[model samples]
Target: MSQLDPYGNQTPNRAPDSWVPDPWLDQPDREPAGEWPTRNGRADEPYTGSGDLPYSEAEAQTAAYPQVQPRAEADAEPATDPVRPRRPGPGKRRATGRAGRNLPAAIGVGVTLGAVVIASLFVWRPAFLAVIVVALGVAIWEMSRAVRAVGAHPPAVPLAAGGLVTIGMAWYAGEDALMLGFLVTLLATLVWRLADGLSGFGRDAAAATLIAVYVPFLGGFAALLAEPDDGARRVIVTLAAVVLSDTGGYVAGVFFGKRPMAPTISPKKSWEGLAGSLVATAVGSAILLYLLLDVEPWWGAVFGLALSIASVLGDLAESMLKRDLGIKDMSNLLPGHGGLMDRLDSILFALPTAYLLLAVFT
Candidate 1:
């Protein structure tokens, strides 16, 4: 055997298995109190060095190349799938659909009912007048309902009295009767308010009183138009003027309109439409004058211009009311149209003006 190193390793001249004792281990007389190094060159104790401990073989392998998680399994829904079916182009009709599907059948019913009423008016004038009175009464009621819908407590008795007085004035008396009836209605409204202890009658009473005059009183002019002594012809002519004007305005505005007529109240109405309405009304009035009345062409032109302007004012008034009430339409009574109020608003003012003109001239 040859000599060896102080450690467990053999010297160059020693055999491979010949071991030597360590110098530190040979010092058995000293106390074992100090820290020692671990196999990876780190201190064995917890508070030894700043370096982190060596990882295990498994951890090192994992750190070398991380295992990526497979993508989550896709859902079975077609819309959510990665390879969804392509949508059809806008030009293509993927499914067959029914025409006239959205049209209201109620409009057809209303038209039929209106025809029956018109027929009854021609056949039996008395019965027609009575039905018209009732219709006006119902319209008054609806006006009251509208007032209430806007959170106002209208004086019901005064409103009903006003409506009745207006109807009576239309039936028996002339313009004098209308003035007297208005005076009586106003006096009665005040009296009724006092009788009710002035409890809830506030601005609502004032508004309701105004509505009574505006809706029923003005609307009663239609009855006056249907009276005898050329009243029927005048009424028909007036209606034709209003209708033709409205139609011409709507069509022209949609096609060639650029400037707004009343941007504050009715943004859709246009100056171009107003001009078209005047032109159409002039033409319609001339035709009616030649056919029905022996009036000059100038007279027809004058009437057309006046009636068109009045109709526009009436429409704007109604639009202002609706804007105040924060509503788009009065009701869904007419499909692709609006309510009776919407249709009759212009006619209401136009009829009375035409009647007065006929009374003066004809």
Candidate 2:
């Protein structure tokens, strides 16, 4: 049956399966989408998308019409609209943690570093001392950069040289030599700062002093651990406690962290994580002390608890420093760890705790 279109033209008779022009895609001046040829070779009426019809109603009319299959386009790959990267639809989005932190790589590097350090400790005292010197150099370098953020420029050369001397003396000469090295580093830093002509001399000198004490003086305590008969065992216990504390905190925080331990300085740190760290370190320290060093389990337990606290303190201290300086990680040297200083932050405090424990126990 012939029917009248909106334009009042008689529509041609056609088969039920014959395709019609889609009005939805048609333009005012151009033909409608997909017009078919009539039986006598004239084109069927083009659907005009114009008119006062509602957009939804026009879409409904288009749906009622079927599109004709063209031979050329048929052989072509289905024209898939480009898969654009999707912006998430409106609603609350998923929460994301610290991005790009490669935990597995960090763990692997930590294990490898620990193995190397333990090996060096037993292989030769000088080798271990060298290792300490190298580590101190890296840490001091990182700190030197950190202080600059606050407009303080410490003397790097004097500080690094003094750090090496401090680490060496702690192992070879004793605590007294280590102290002397620290004092000399301070004097040298002050003298070096004087050359810059008093603009920020006080700030620079003070920062240098901090660098001297923080990197080498405090770190020198690790060398003293080697002074005892089973120094390597003591070193191992110290490291194990700190490492266990960190690992426990991370694992627990991931699974069960609720309350933030420090909201401003380190937002991710949680009380639950700290508790996990303490418990794990306590147990681990006791085992290492009793089995490895053959020390009394009670003493091991005390050392564990103490070192765990020390480790947390060290981590917090570093976080505070970073927050003050407005920096995230110390550097990008280590993939998961951030930088050398990041890894050393907790151990710096743990070293002194180990030395104290050794002094008391021995």
Compared with the true structure, model 2 gives a TM-score of: 0.74
| Candidate 2 collision pairs | none
Candidate 1's TM-score? 0.68
Candidate 1 local lDDT, 87-123, one digit each (tens): 8789653332121222354346446645755675567
Which candidate number has the best TM-score? 2
**Tens-digit per-residue lDDT, 1-362, candidate 2:** 67665566877784546646557544446545355434344445443445554445555688899877798887789868898887887764443335347757776888889988988988876678778888889999999998899999998988898788878887888889989988988898789779879898888888998888789999999889877778888888889999899888888888999999999988889999999998899888888899988888888888889998999999999999999999989998887778899999999999988898868875
Write down the TM-score of every candidate.
0.68, 0.74
Whole-model Cα lDDT of every candidate shown, in order? 0.70, 0.84
Instruction: Indicate which candidate wins on lDDT.
Output: 2
Q: How many backbone clashes does every candidate have?
A: 0, 0
State the RMSD for candidate 1: 11.9
What lDDT, from 0 to 1, does candidate 2 have? 0.84
